[model samples]
Target: MKEYKFLRILDKFEKIYTKIGVDYDKMRLILSMKLTLDSRRTSTIMQDQNKNNNEEDKNIFNRALIIYAIMGIFIGITAMVSFNNMYKFSILFGMFMFLVLTIFISDFSNVLLDIRDKNIIGTKGIDNKTINAAKITHICYYIFLTSLALSWLAIIGSFRQSPLVGIIFILELIVIDVFMIVLTALLYLLVLRVFDGEKVKDIINFAQIALVIIMTISYQFLGRMFDIVDLNIIYKSKIWNLFFPPMWFAAPIYAIEGGHINQIIIALIVLAIIVPIIAIILYIKNTSKFENSLSKLNIAKDNEKEKKRGLFYKIGRNLCFNNEEKAVYDLSTSIIKKEREFKLMTYPSLGFVVIFPLLFILIFSVDSFSEIKNISLHMSLNIYWFIFMVPTILMALQYSKDYKAAWIYQSTFVNDKRNIYKGAYKAVISNLLLPLYLLESIMFIVIFGMKVIPILIIGFIFMLIFIVIQHIISKNKLPFTLKMGEIDKGQNIISTLLGMVILGVAVGVNYFILINTYLLIIYGVILTIITFIMWKKCILDFSTN
Candidate 1:
């Protein structure tokens, strides 16, 4: 086994795990070896063939860490709301665990399981118990590191109060982390044991999408919860403690601090100790079954290729386009739908567009519907919606993980490249823009009532104009034909910001100047003419590199 930094630290606890039917040293060695190999594999891809790529990877990681830190700060600041250390610790730890759990679900397969590891290490005489244990250890180390970073200030403050409180805080976090890891592992193993490997793999993919949705939703809701429910509410209604796992740890701390500890807290504390043990037992018993299915995960099902032609294809073919345009539209939609990397990159942004606008409305509103019904409010939100939508979808259309495969576009003997753009435009409109527009329109109607129809119509027209302008500026690449790493991030950000500003001004004008229906019609017609000219320019004169 390689001399892993983690394993070297674990060496001090040799006698502990050895007592529980675990070959502590041997398991550490195997785990260290497997994780080392996996790290090398990831590092190789991240660093790639040059120094610049390595720097870019570092920057991306740093940016990711910064985002995580920002999330932590939000929770930390929320935790500071009450002077009660118990409430502060509970809220911060709970939110941190939630974020960590989200990350675990999103990246667990790649980070811990590494389906490839099953094949690589299967030949080595390692038992399922050892591999599974190593996986738990590997996941724990990283999540703990992240938790430490997230809770540094809170933990330090706890230590200021008393060394025991701080030590308990750290120990409680370890227990919670262990419970979460075991719970997730048990869930994965159970799914594998019950369902086929391919099904489990599909579930994992879908779960990633769900994780993003959940992340945004949880952030918004959890922040709201902290704002609404303070220590008084929590103390009065102990039922809240029963639902939140972090409260289990917090209750014990409260008890230690000479605070009131009730039956609910006592039960939670007991469950906190028992649940992880049960999870570990369940995982160990199912490891062989899990491993068997995992090894066969990559084997393609014969039925996958036989998927029937769906409504998307029918819609694509019948879209009001000439043959060339229809072909581009179909191809573009196909890539967006079928390409995993494209879905990963694009769907999250689409989900964000779906989520963020509503969240912003809720955040700003006194009575949600009453505030939303205000013309200026809805117009501003619509401006933000269209602004974010155009850039995100356009940028998503430009990138593909397998960009080299795009050579087919260059090889084809086509004189008019604009037809390809037209087709791609239709794809963007029908597949991406239309659904989003309908969703926004429906939401507007619901929130503001039937009287909002004219505003929605006006908003849709402006969105169309924005989309056309974006296409003229952005649709130079063949759809899904550029590598993600090669994308101009600054260009996209600038375009998005500029779109927001222009549309924001338009929103203000339409609200203040074109308040009545008659003035709105006049403005809409003028905008329509401008949009038509831009559309013509986009399809006829614009060329992509």
Candidate 2:
């Protein structure tokens, strides 16, 4: 295997590392193996892993950095945009920090929380410092690569303004990265320290879910935080803005450029520096504790308590038609309920389905409380928007990291194979979409009134028929049988757009139908029949692969 350039650079610091009581050589070896193994796995955010195992595709991580560099061009533009300093940098750093934090949470969490290293290597007489150093370096290497890709343009832009400005940006950038990493580690460490057994493990898992939810909601507020008119930006700070970290990081630049300082700016500067320093010290002290906390991941859960999942089985029994369908329904719902990675991947889209359109309505669709009652037609059309999630969610359902376990599906006897997807489709709808559509329906009914209920039922039934046709007709992969490495983000975007287009046609057809209540009732009946026929056949009767 080719040596990593970063490893060669580290060789020069070997004496320093060794003197600091780390086994530098062993640490390097461990990190090298990690990189090599990771090279075979595709990144979730940046690129598709070439399933062909092409030689050229081995540099997937390098190509991912290139994508980040391309994204950095926007940061450069934001830094140099013609606007007030605080407003622009708050926006810039908001984008910067969001990228760093989200990427760290999704991609690096697996690396950080993985217990195989501790289990396998800790038994071989590797010192604590060496193992910990190796783990920390694995994380830092990715963060450094990310920052290098994402900050180069911003650094250049700041340098053009003033060398000191550029230097300060670099220093604060490092500090912010350190603060985020340390703070996250500290949260997990404290939870593990305080709680015992399955509770801490379950709490840590939900913490990731909570972070995703909070991050997505905050993302919506970013656009709302500024007022833009005729290409000019205006931002007025409120006391509430103190809740956002981007504002704190951006204040120093504003103060520096304005040639004045205030108590608020001084406080922010102290926070920007002091908090990270404190966090680093505490994190360093808890290094052993951090290692122990990661070991909790290896704890085996009591499967006996899974009777609580009887609710999931009841959902399958209620939704499917036959035993074959019921078995697969139980299997699909179980995975959806238990898999952390599935929730992480799908929750953002799940949130977007609600947030994007509701925010649109709040900001653009209605001007006053009275105007909401007049939006019946708007609500009717927007009901179809939930179909936008079908392509993405169904695609997510097809791919899994544990695709090999799917062999169980093939090894089992099935008289009717089509019932397998039937069950799987019903499970996804019942478990994921049914609740989302119903929740959105309630909100829409509250806003547009009970008059929207018929439309929601028609729209939802139509979605079930439409999704089965799209999935079974387009690319029918057995549930959870495809490696996630085969996915391309571009493919997801295109599929989602196609879903919108298909549903848009129905919305147009329903527009004239809405002109007559009788025609709308007839339209819904036809859709119900189509859904029944689809349940009868899933594109020539498919089987789990």
| Best-performing candidate as measured by lDDT | 2
The alpha-carbon root-mean-square deviation between model 2 and the true structure, to one decimal in Å, is: 4.0
Q: Candidate 2 clashing pairs?
A: none
118: Cα error in model 2, Å: 0.8
* Model 2, position 255: C-alpha lDDT score: 76
- The list of candidate 2 runs beyond 4 A from truth reads 1-3, 8-26, 40-57, 127-130, 190-202, 222-234, 303-313, 362-386, 439-452, 488-494, 506-523, 538-545
Candidate 1 lDDT, tens digit per residue, 229-302? 54353443255556566656766667777766667768767766777678777766676666676765565454
How do all models score by TM-score? 0.76, 0.84
All candidates: CA RMSD in angstroms?
Answer: 5.0, 4.0
RMSD of 1: 5.0
lDDT of each: 0.63, 0.73
